[model samples]
Target: MRRRNVLRACLILLAASQLPSPAQAEQIIRMSTTYTTADSGLLAYLLPMFEKRTGAEVKVVITGTGKALELAKHGEVDVSLTHARPAEDKLVAEGYGVKRHDVMYNDFILVGPANDPAGIKGGKDVIAAMKKIIAGKARFVSRGDNSGTDLIEKAYWKQIGDRPQAPAYISAGAGMGEALTMAADKEAYALTDRATFAAYKAKTGLVVAVEGDPKMFNPYGIIAVNPAKYPGVNYKGATQLIDWITSDEGQRAIAAFRVAGQQVFFPSAKVGR
Candidate 1:
């Protein structure tokens, strides 16, 4: 009977040893985010800290802003971080997202070859610079991926009332990094977020041709997928991530993220949230 008892205890201990440990059972939250955020290395810098604190890992889906929001809408991700305020607001209004919390911001800038084919170098007026590019028939690379940068570029062309013709206008239908590479290869002008441009500048050798336009202000927001709509979604984890990202520590992390010694992203989270 003592041997039987010892055997039962050994069996129980073996079963327990085979089960997953608490640390091995860490929760995973699916996050869909813009290409710029990932390409700029912000996630690499920030996510580990959050994971260490909460023991919840973030699985990032890197895509354009439009697709990022679409992932949230389709219940494919627990949360989304994207730029383009109008689209973000629309997602929240459509009940796909719980709420939109301001995260950070970086402006869009026109970048082109060092020779400045369009003659709009150092220009503050993005609209006028775009006009000059069109008028000069300079090759312009378009993301055409429906990204936040792409949407902003289309808006600029809409305001200009004309866009470059084909051959002069090349739609890459790719991410920011690839589009920038295409621009560099073609020696064409491209609109890009400052953070991504800073990250890729050395590799692409593209110079900023236009910047400092009020219309170029690009802000990012994080939204938790609505639990009411997608009951299976990790809404708790999503909210935890949203809250932590908008918190003081996350804001400071955003402020501290730099590319090539330049502060690329500015924290825009409201205080007391």
Candidate 2:
């Protein structure tokens, strides 16, 4: 009973005026997603198709993937789209999520000034490339927000033995685009997803120096919050949505997505990344 009240208050607080009005004859599905190019990345593809085919109004709550997952965990939203694999796996394994589906993939690339001060360019080994960045002590920008990118960056540093203290190293508790902009402003290096980097590259003036390394591969996964864990969740609608995303039409939409003739993200359903 207490939990029910808490959930109600949360929804009321977050409830958007954009939600369908009572007279609108529209169905709203609240979706949580990362503060990603999701505006142009997945939602730009899937939401339109879903709405066109189903006549439902999709209400999106844009935030970090971590915050999105938290919304799902609390039954604050119907679904979550995220790129953090280990976090997703933990949620699925712990019964907070159900029906995991591979939506798409893009590799993470280390972007630096065209000068390539760290000499990270053309380094096939990700660890070796990372080590060079550290050894050079060249200014490297980090998201540092416990975001998927930050999580992966920290994991990479952990894989290496001892890293220099995080002093001159800059931490931007901001989104990918903002962090990329920050990197560009300082003429520094940053790790970013290919899709966002490609979309914002021209505006930011950063160049991709290290890519094609297997470790740089980033895959996106969709999961419905398990109704059993958070009974307030819309299990039926969530299932329907997840089913559509993993289907051929949805997968094809993901593959068809491109910006300026550059295919930044690739479909990862039939094969592994």
C-alpha TM-score for every candidate: 0.91, 0.86
Can you write out model 1's per-residue Cα lDDT over 1-273, one digit (the tens) per residue? 999999999999999999857554337799999999989989999999999999898999999999999999999999999998999999999999999999989999999999998899989999999999999999999999999999999999998899999999999999999999999999999999999899999999999999899989999999999999999888888989988899999899999999999999999999684
Clashing pairs in model 1?
Answer: none
Question: Residues 141-254, candidate 2, lDDT per residue (tens digit)?
Answer: 888877788888888989997453565478998888889999998888888888888878899889888888898888888888888887766666667776777777777787
Candidate 1 Cα errors over 4 Å, as ranges: 1-26
Q: Which candidate is the best by TM-score?
A: 1
Best by lDDT: 1
**What C-alpha lDDT, on a 0 to 100 scale, does residue 262 get in candidate 2?**
84
C-alpha lDDT values of all predictions: 0.93, 0.79
**Stretches > 4 Å off in candidate 2:** 1-26, 37-40, 164-167, 270-273
